[model samples]
Target: MYTPPAFRIDDRQRLVATIRDAGLATLVTATVEGLMATPLPLLLDETEGPHGTLYGHLARANPQGRLPAIGGEALAMFSGPDAYVTPAFYATKQETGRVVPTWNYVAVHAYGTLELFDDPDRLLNLVRRLTERHEASRPMPWSVADAPEDFIRAQLRGIVGLRLQISRIEGKCKASQNRPAADREGVAAGLAASDRPADREMAALVAAAPP
Candidate 1:
C-alpha cells in the first residue's frame, strides 16, 4: 500500500466502512513452506478493540489453516470499486497531450496476528452473525435458526474459525484526487457512461474526490 498523501485515507470509520462493504478479503500469511493466501468473507467487530477484530472461517480441508506461521502477522486486503482510466478520459490529454492512462481504485489492507480457533460455540456464533449481515438486505432474510440444529452443527465441524486482532490498517482511495478539476470531471463523466457497475461506482467516488 504505497499511498501518496493525496490518495491516503486515514479515517478509521471510513476505512472500516469500506471493509464492511467489501464483504470478502484476501488473507495472506507467510508460512514455513511458502506464502499462503485465502479468500474469505470476514466480519469486523468494531467494538472489540481499539482498531477492530476480524472474524472469518476457512474450510477444514484448506491447508493454509494448518501451516506453521513464519511471522507473527497476517495481511487481509479488501478491495472496493476500481476502473480503468484511459488517457482519452482526461481532458488534459486534449489540451497538453501530457496525460497518460491510469487506474482509479479503493483498497484497504489490515495487518494483524493470526488467531485460529476451532471452538464450536465460537464458530456457530460467527456463522450466525455473518449470515445475518448478508441476509438482512434480502427480500426473505434467512437465519441460522432456519436450519436444523444437527445439520448446522455438522456443517460447523467442517470449518475452522479465524480471528485477527488488527494491529494496523492502510487505506488508499485513488479516485482522481491528483488530477486537475477538469480532468477529474472528465474521468467521472466517462466512467459514469460505462456499462460496468464497478465503473459506475468509481465514477461516483471520483466525482466526490477533492481537487
Candidate 2:
C-alpha cells in the first residue's frame, strides 16, 4: 500500500474496474487472537455508499465469520495482472547498465467496516446475484433456480453473508511507468512475447501507460 506518486492510481473508475476484473480478493481482519484472512470472490455494490459496499460469503464452519474484527475495519486486497521485468528488457541496460530487475503489476486495497448476516432472504438474493455475475460470460449460464428449492435452501444454511461498507480504497499500478519511453516499449515487447497469459495481460497495461 506504500505507493509512490508515480504509481498511485486515484481514478475512481479505474479502481472500480480493477476490483471488478480481479476475480478474487484476500479479505483480512484483526481479531483478539491474531489476524485472519480468507480468499473470496466478492461483488461490489457501487451505488450503496460513498465509495461502495462489498458482498461475499464464507462457509459457516470458517472461524473468520464467527470472530469479531477488533478494529472498526477490515482489508480486502485485489491483485491484478503482474509480470517479472528482467534487466534484459530495459534499453538502459545496454546504454548505462543501470537497470535492475523489478516487477510490474496492479493492486487495489479496500478498507471497510465488516458486517455479517445470515438472514435466508438476504442470503438467497446475494447468492442469486453472485451466480449471475459469474455465469454471464458462460455459453450456458447457470442460476440458483436451476436446482431444487429444498436443496438450495439446505445449501444456503451452511454459509454466512458478508457486507463491508468501504471507507477507503487505494490502487497502485507499477507498469513500467517510471521507465524511459524506449525502455518501457522494450518491456512491453518482451512481456507480449511470453507464453504466460498474466505476462501478456501485463504487457497491454504497460503499453497503455503514459509514456
lDDT tens readout by residue for model 1, 1-211: 8999999999998899999999899999998888999999999999887889999999999988888567779999999999999999888999999988899999999999989989999999999999999999999999999999999999999999999989999999999998999999999999999999999999999999887
RMSD of each candidate?
A: 1.0, 0.9
Off by over 4 Å in 1: none
lDDT of 2 by residue, 1-211 (tens): 8999889998999999999999899999999879999999999999999999999999999999999999768999999999999999998999999978999999999999999999999999999999999999999999999999999999999999999999999999999999999999999999999999999999999999985
Model-by-model lDDT, in order?
Answer: 0.94, 0.95
Residue 66, candidate 2: alpha-carbon lDDT? 92
In terms of lDDT, model 1 sits at 0.94
lDDT of 2 at 11: 98
Cα displacement (Å) at residue 193, model 1: 1.0
TM-score of 1: 0.97
Number of the top lDDT candidate: 2
Which residue pairs does candidate 2 place in steric collision? none
